[model samples]
Target: MKVAASMNRIDVNEVSKPEPDPVLVVERVSMKFNLGEQSVTAVDDVSFSVRPGEVFTVIGPSGCGKSTLFNIIGGLLGHYEGEVRIDGSKIAGSHESIGMVFQEESTFPWRNVIDNVAFPLELKGMGKSERLDRARHFIDMVGLSGFERHMPAQLSGGMRQRVAIARTLAYEPRILLMDEPFAALDEQTKLLLGEKVMEIQQRLKQTTLLITHNLSEAVQLSDRILIMTYRPGRVKRILDIKLDRPRTADVVGSEAFGRYVAEIWADLREEATRGMSDAESARR
Candidate 1:
């Protein structure tokens, strides 16, 4: 008799547990794009590492190449010169365990919330029952319990972003790469989703790298924040958030958190402003 094919189910608990080894270790990474005869450097020699179960954030000016850095780490920007190591191995191309959420809405208008969340699982070749179960679990984790059947068009901007996160999480990735995922939402929605994301990160203890230009968002969500300089972006500072766990967006208003934010802004604001000017000139 032929035996039934048993697929391996991803256990979130196993993913939550900290790896004895570092999850991501980026060293001296740089990227350059060719526009005609001119060479454009989007990212300079930037280096950082994320340990297992860390909420690591990269923040900078709008054109400071934060997203470029994320692509390098995700193996999406391979044309760059320098090294990006995930789990101690140098990444050469698209990596399987690195799940990404872009700034744009990633949901399919045709697919319902559950289906959108299950897309990654389907791509992984998981069976219908198993993928649906995992998708539902992540949808609930992102606070979209009753709206599992709702279409992307039916959900709010924040809800759509939540679905995107659920889709990434359902893959049970070793690392999550989020590029300004909440930048398009309303302020109130951004605040709420930011807090919810932080809570989920803490509960799951996933090693995540979030790239954003929002200072408050970086402070509220990350254990460590990496600041980048303009044009050819390079690491400016790495500020460790000393505050205790389970931090909310409101924590940004606290005196201690305020001090950290102010200090980091002070260090980068001038360079960030200059970066914008450089970008404008390049456009012309």
Candidate 2:
């Protein structure tokens, strides 16, 4: 699909350093949901914008409205309080040009990998042959070249996630939204997949917003990390990650990287502890 090409064209030299353009802007966004006698506020007064070709991350403790924020931005939930704009256009109830990948196993058990990857294309009434051809390229892009015929049951957790990512990338949206896509995997798999995902993002330079709880992950994969406070989430701080590109485990061990991680960790530790206490109180 030619749309894929438009989303992937980024100058390598301009990737690690992106010029200013608001690809996705969230302004005075807040979310409140009612559950019978009580109301729960998930996000409160949150505002930020993802610059073009930048990996912007939102991190917070569990139930701090990070996922809720993502849902609003993806146009999956319209019941929220404020505005989410994609390329300056409001996306309150639209999913026309944004790609999304979630933490769950999104693969279809009944469909083969090729068909699963091509499902989105098929939904748009694309021809089978053309969809298959496009799916094949994305399949290889995510490093699942030989497993095109495999079903969901035949692949590992990492492989399944790869398929999900490939499926999202095939359509090539203006912004890619990911919600802890590697959290369910083992540490090794998560790290490896994170690296692969970062590489692909670097090459494509697509505007991305990733929601994560892992401090190191937020540091390693993002150009800037937006730390959120406890429930009724708000931006605590936006820490810039200045580590060199093609980030690896080696970078994590560097002195400068350690300092950067420590800075973000200092902000997150207290918020995370508060979140735990809140969960315990809710359980009681």
Candidate 3:
């Protein structure tokens, strides 16, 4: 696991007070899936709130329904029970303020980098020139400045994911919902992109909710992490990360960082074991 060190870090001494308003409120949310005559609860009465400009992460075992909760928040799964509110108002369908970056590569193979990023703005009725101009800014932000015209096949996995992130940011959503966006990349690339994401979040102060299985990545990027139980997921615990700001890839070496990783691992190990046992019995 890569640890993060401080680089171009935000100055704590010059930090301004944050407003008290929460950007997202997920209240008593539950979700179930039906297959023929059988039904399974994926998430059970989960509740949490994400503060403005905060990077809040959810981590759990493979079948813990982390992705299910993310879909519910993004308004992609409307069959869910309970309320999901954004900016204090109930989310009826897909709200304009929410944006999602999935683990799967969502870049359009037919369009180049700039066009892919601008596609969202285009859908919003933005003019061609204006949308492309706006797309360039985000492309540059994700460090893909020279590759503006590169096709998705021409880029590496990491570069492709950057395009996806730039595309999401082009919409300028108030909250970013990232579901394991780095899970597909190699370790080195994953660490580099994770650092890039932290830098972007710090600079933009966009409220972000990330669902990840990587504990090290969770600790590096999150202000607080919500750990959930196995299938029929529930909030097991929410840990506040006290690490300093401007964390680079080197911070993973610190003793404090190790402790945080260890603590979360201890909690997750028990749940993972239970999930394994359940699967074994079901297979019999």
Clash numbers, per candidate: 0, 0, 10
> Tens digit of lDDT per residue, candidate 1, span 1-284?
01101212223233223346778877777888899999988998777778889988898987788888877777777778777777777888879879999999888999999999999899989999999999999999999999999999998889999999999999888898999999999888988899998888888888899999988888788888887888778777677777677787778778867776776688688888797777778799
Best by lDDT: 3
CA lDDT scores, all candidates in order: 0.83, 0.83, 0.88
Give the lDDT of residue 55 in candidate 3: 94
Candidate 2 per-residue C-alpha lDDT over 151-206 given as tens digits, one digit per residue, 9 for 90 to 100 = 99999999999999998888878788999999889988887788888888988988
Regions of candidate 1 where Cα sits further than 4 Å from its true position? 1-20, 279-284
Error of 1 at 58 (Å): 0.8
Error in Å for residue 210 of model 2? 0.1
TM-score of 2: 0.90
Clashing pairs in 2: none
